[model samples]
Target: MANDTKIFHESWYRIANEKLCLRSSVKVHRQLFRGARWYVLSDPFNNQFYRLRPEAYEFVIRLGLDRTVEEVWMEMISAAPESAPGQEEVINLLVQLYQSNLLHYEMPPDSAKLFDRYKNKKQRIMKSNLLNIMFFRIPLFDPDSFLKNILPLIRLIMNPLGAILWLTVVGSAIKIVIDRFAEVSVQTQGIINPSNLFLLYIAMLLVKTFHEFGHAFAVRRFGGEVHIIGVMFLLFSPVPYMDATAAWAFRNKWQRILVGAAGMITEIFVAALAVFVWANTSGGLLHSLAYNMMFVASLSTVVFNINPLLRYDGYYMLSDWLDIPNLHTKATQQLTHLVEKYAFGYKRSTSQAYSLKEAFWLAIFGVLSGIYKLIVFASIIFFIADRFLLAGIIMALICCITWIIVPLVKLIKYLSSSPKLERIRLRAITVVSILLLFVVGFFYYFPFPNSFRASGVLKASEYFVVNSKVSGYVKKIEIEPGSQVSAGQPLIILENKEIDLQINEAMASLQESYAMRQLALAERPEDLATVEARIQAIQTRLDRLQHDREELVVKAEISGVWVVGNVADYLGMWIRRGAPIGQIINESAYYFASVIPEVHTSRIFDNEVKRASVKLVGQADTEVPVFRYVKIPMEQTILPSAALGWKAGGDVPIDPNDAQGVHSTEPFYEVRAYLDNNNGMKMFHGRTGKIRFELTSEPLLRQWWRSFRQLVQKRYHY
Candidate 1:
């Protein structure tokens, strides 16, 4: 019982003399919650249902057109005062039943009051839906008759045999997805691409159509009516929806859970079929459509329908499985109760939780769900804003008004005027004011540690790029990779059969010229000169050929680690002259080449940076200090290493046209910082890492504003 409730209501006198009874059209059903039986009064005409406790149900059943409210109340109190509801409870129950059209009254004035309450209830529902513009819905027609028509087919599929088939298909699809996981993952990158938007939306509509029918058919199969079928504009995108609340009247909790999970089950089955279609097809409209269908089903089921944090199918299933009806509403009430009872020191505040375990769960779920909702909403706003700025702005304004501004106004009104807080009103106001001030101070006034990270690769300050000096096939690798070698050490050996043959031929020609010259000297002095010239020319060609043969042996020019890669794999491979073989890195000196984005360069360049450090991807825990640094003032689109670009698994965006992945889509400033590698770790050349620059402390509010401004300037060019 609430603290606000009394033994009797002052206005009970006006209803005490009135005679009322249960409407003949109202049907009662029984269900169990927390092992206790609860009765549900279903008004078929309005498709509305209300739950009643055993005591309240007894009082309601005893009332009739011939019996007055006072008579039933007096008998109930006299018979069982401990279990019986008080007069105040009775009055409230009567008013609720009357508003639900479950109560029949003989008086015209009472009927008029009930009609006004019903109209007000409708208005409140409309206002509430309007406030939730992101998930707005429009009812089209009744689905009960249509579901009834398909009852036989629904029964055929929603059974044991159907479950087996669903499992087999879904299992096969799961296997296919796992086998081709890489391809599927790559395809997901283009799911939201402008070219696929039309097909994606079409796929979503088709999948959602079946999904809503799944719920309707499940309800109808279990002897329940689905009255409303409509379109819900989820994130301003139209999707099919259905009313399955009639499942709440089922006596079996598992039945209710089944009704809730039916949609997801149907969607997964459809997605499984889509997987087969997508996997088998090559490339066409059908293939794209199948892929899109799979994308829509999996994304929606995982992100929304199956997530218990949102008020979707999974949430209802969780509630039914836990035997906790109105879990979300009760959680909010539990939080409010805690605030009133503990925070404001209210003695009369009642808890919504029935046990300590329930209270703990309620509190945890309340906090998490609230936080998740905010994150989801903010993410959606930003996601839409990236594409449609105007639509995003409108959604953001609606969310701010509904979630923040209106709630704050209501909280202030409650703290000032709530009757339950009459004695502790001043304390409540003070506590709330302090909380608000603290929150504001934390965001706008308090200093926080400020730092930014840029992606780049480590580079050796001194390194020699070993290149092949001769065009020949590799015969042998003289030194292994990472071996210490002398300056004149042979790194690799190459062979040129053509050069060897030429040298042999040149030597033979020179010997022949020498013999001819000897003969010419005895015959004619002029001929002897010509023979001598020929011998010299032949000798010169032989020397050049021998020199070319000597050049076939590739030797290290500098002493350092021999950084040849896959040394054994180079055997018999043809190498062109001047091609880079590997880098001979001098590990004594190393530096980080950090790619600072254009937006962050201005902040770090003009601000006083406290310190800078390097965190290599290979050694994430070790932070190497920067001994010295230099910033290149010019804007450059080319990255120092391809590993720093998105194409190579880095955060930096790469230009789609750059196949080498060394060119960034935007220009960035490269900061070279000599790292102190004295920390007993070797830094390799071209190793990827992040450079962290600790800057001056700033408030979170200011940081957020600056980020927002940068985003606008970058996206809109203003």
Candidate 2:
């Protein structure tokens, strides 16, 4: 309900009796937001929409040629005094409508003023286009005729039956995709390769064309015209786009949402079809194309189209779903209202939100959008800079001017010249200056706790691997895995019948040679010496055979816990010479081996390490402290264990071709920190964990700058 008290500006009072009315060309549409009735005034010629409150809508509806603005105001006050807009609000509403070309005066308008307004609007639009050069659009032919021609053919599928069919196709595609997920994932990595760039772009174009058509067709299905179809230069790449603003006039929220969602739905359907093709077909050009289509379609739909942070299809869909039109503008207004009302003590500043819940959403969205825009813009600038340095620098400067400089200049202008700040300019300036100083001081002077974490694995200080000394068959398993065994303890028992037979034959030969030597000794001394030498050779051969037979049993070389991967599988199996049986890990002495990226090595060496702790992946609640540490100077591409690589579902990236997942894509410095074992932490040889090194406290701003520089260096090799 509007306040019954009538308040008007002195200037508004001068024009209170002026005759004004809504233009015949302007159309009004009723809408509801947060359970409150509101009206949307649209200028179809200009494709502009302005939302009005119930009281304002009532005032607009009451205006006519027969009654002056004063007459309408009096009649409104007499009818619904509690619900009628005050004189100040009435003047403001009329000004907004007139500015929007939605209102007309009884008197002839000044041609010079009208032309100046038109030129100013054009200049603003052109300036916006120039600022957003990365996403500038080039309008092509109208898509309405093309849509009309195809509307009849696709009209049948634009219904419930088509929805069911789409669901079925998507469901089947999902199953096929799941079955071949590994294959698809591997192929997706090649999409960004220079060799595949052409095909990838082609696929992207085709998919986006389909996407835009989906929007156009959906609008046409709902009795709306798609006047413009164009190519948007998104990040220097041309992608199809369409203007489906006719859906804004939709009365049904769901209809508007459907139109917004139709593009994504179409892209998903194309991706589904691509999935089927890619799954059934063997490796070839067609298969590659299909895969690229599926990749681009799915990726763009999720990352861009469906992301509500972007002003894309998902943004509109979300707006309609929440019954909040012009969500972005309203969110900005809410933020401005907060700053004015609380920060500047502008008590008269009214919130754009109808309720607390709406205010909360608007505030949250406002902050999120601002942050997201900055991140996205910065990322794009960096990405382009990495490739084309000079072009990237120019673009960055332009973006900085448009996004940062312009806004700051506008803010300064508002603070100095805005009429609303006239009464409390000094107070506002003092408050704003203090706030800015506080923020800068907090970021610069404050010492924040600094820590960096890296993935690592717990490894035994020493490991004793038990291997077979001779080729034999495993006859018995003596010890189970994880069992503590003493040095020379039998871990596995093996039997070899061939070695036993050889030993027996050598023993018999030795006995024969000894007997012959005795016989020769009686005949001749020289012959006896030769026979004795033969007997000695035979005896040595027999001794070697016996030693080989005794080597069948495998024993632990050190006292530690036995770790056998699959001891049961080796039972009764032929063991090759030097084949590993199991390992004896000294769990009492353990250390965490962490791989630190080469870029972060400077920070590690520069800062004094205050403390360190290790948290096992699964048991993250427990933190084991490091007693001592040693940094290895060597740069290596081979990961210490597969548990710390991408192939094994870990955070580090490794060569996919490596079967063991041990080969890292980038070289890293290894650091081993001795763990305190007194806590009786269950230590495994290759248990994956994260090791955090606490460094000396530093200002947050400095830390962030360091981290950002490190990121740039690592990603772009700058």
Candidate 3:
């Protein structure tokens, strides 16, 4: 609840004696936000807006051109003592109104002071522009006349019927996109290529142009004026922007929300149209352009425009929908209020939230948005630095100054000068100092449990891949798959009638040749050489046939479990030379074959790894201990199993051209960790799981710094 009890600031004594009132041109409008009645004070001449609670509004309404601030306060106190604004609140309200140029003093304002105030306002705007350099905007022209000229033609489509038609078209486009998902996915990869960059930029320009116009048209449709149209450097890329501040005065929340959402809706509609054009057209300049338009439209809308974390169209829309005005600013204030009230024990500090629920939401949004901004800015800085080092470094310095240095300086100024801490300055300083030290100590000195995980598949350490040694028919199945087998154990029996007949024929011929050789030796010495040559050839053929007859049975090469796929299907089936039979795996000797990212190799190799374990994907609770590990020196693009790649529903990205999905897009080192099989966990070949390596205990700050450096080195090659 607002503090209605009277609390006067020392400066209020002088201000209370002076008579002040709002300018005649200033208008006051009633509004209800979050179930509480409020007033919006608007200065038409300056186009400025200020929101005030009902109590504050009541106090303001009582002030007149001839009435003194002290008189108004006394009358408000008599009329509603419990709901009246306190003296301090009244003084703050007057200061805000005066600063916004909505107030007129009884005496003529000094020209020099007025000029100084104007200069200060300009300086503030310049400072804000400098801080937000990444999203800076420069107004170039008035677009109201242009919007007025186009309004008549577009008025008919800015209604419910038009909305229905848009939905129908967009729905159909969504279906087409889903149907040709693969084609669209492949096209996305080419959007960033140098050959298509100009086309992509053109597409982006057109889409953003349409988006800005969408907001303008929506505002115009709802009797709002759009005075300024300009270019904004969004992430250092120039794009169209428009001022739609007129929508802020709209009585209906839905109207305000529609104005905010208009840009995204327009972008989506354009993307839907582009989808149709891209789908129907054959490969050409037009087709490529249409596809690029679709890509940019969808990407920019989702990534920047519609995302609520960033201060964009969606953020405004969310604020309006939730009945929260100036959400970002208020949330920030709420956080500051929390630190002041709770941490510093400042009694006068107050939250911008109207209720506890609002305070909770504000805190949540503040933290999330703060973190998101850091991530976004960091990414942009690194991205620019990778392209242009000197420019990027300058930008980084500016960002650090604006985001870090400026905020810290302001905080120190507040701590040193703010009157709210007059009584507890020493206490606040001591508490804040201790808190800061505690945080630093926790991050720098405390040891934390740290581990890195990688996906892998289980395999037998020693396994023999069985293949057919001779061509024949699979006559009989001597052993089943997964059954225990010994070395030289018969797994399959093969028979070939042709081989048997050939062996018999060779033996008969050999016998005949032997007889002829003997007869030649006894009767004719000259013919003995020819008979001996024939006998040698026949004996050689007989020996080969006898050897083939002995190799009719397929046997296990080593003693272990017999592993064969579709062994029964091979029974009575014709077998070919060098065909795969299966493997005889030593089940007891199982290991996990994992691929570790090149960046993480330092953590595995440089650090002393304390422990390692493997967890099967579906069996989250079961952890298989690893007894030994070996890292392959060679980096390979091929993964150990398809199960560990994207195409097979795994996390790792694979080359799109690799139909088998076993080829990784980036090279990774393969590491084999022997798993202890004594835990009674069923081990299977090709079973996918995650392997975690626990490294030596270290402070989290050091680990985070190392990981960040590794990422920078890997990505920027620094």
Winner by TM-score: 2
Which parts of model 2 have CA positions greater than 4 angstroms off? 1-6, 34-36, 64-67, 106-119, 378-395, 501-546
Distance from true position, residue 86, model 2, in Å? 2.1
How would you encode candidate 2's per-residue C-alpha lDDT over 405-425 as one tens digit per residue? 999898889889988898888
Question: Can you write out model 1's per-residue Cα lDDT over 556-637, one digit (the tens) per residue?
Answer: 8888888977876789999998998887877778889999998898778998888999999979999999888898898999
- Candidate scoring better on TM-score of 1 and 2: 2
Screening candidate 3 with a backbone cut-off below 3 angstroms (N, C-alpha, C), the clashing residue pairs are none
lDDT of 1 at 492: 87
User: In terms of lDDT, which candidate is stronger, 2 or 3?
Assistant: 3
Residue 199 lDDT in model 3?
Answer: 92
| lDDT of each residue in 591-687, candidate 3, tens digit only | 8999898878888878888999999877779988988999888889999889999989888899988998999998899889998867698888888
Better structure of 1 and 2 per lDDT:
1
Q: Output the worst ten-in-a-row residue range by lDDT, candidate 1.
A: 110-119
Clashes of each: 0, 0, 0
The C-alpha lDDT values of all candidates are 0.87, 0.84, 0.85
How close to the true structure is residue 474 of candidate 3, measured as C-alpha lDDT? 92
Per-prediction TM-score to the true structure, in the order listed: 0.89, 0.91, 0.89
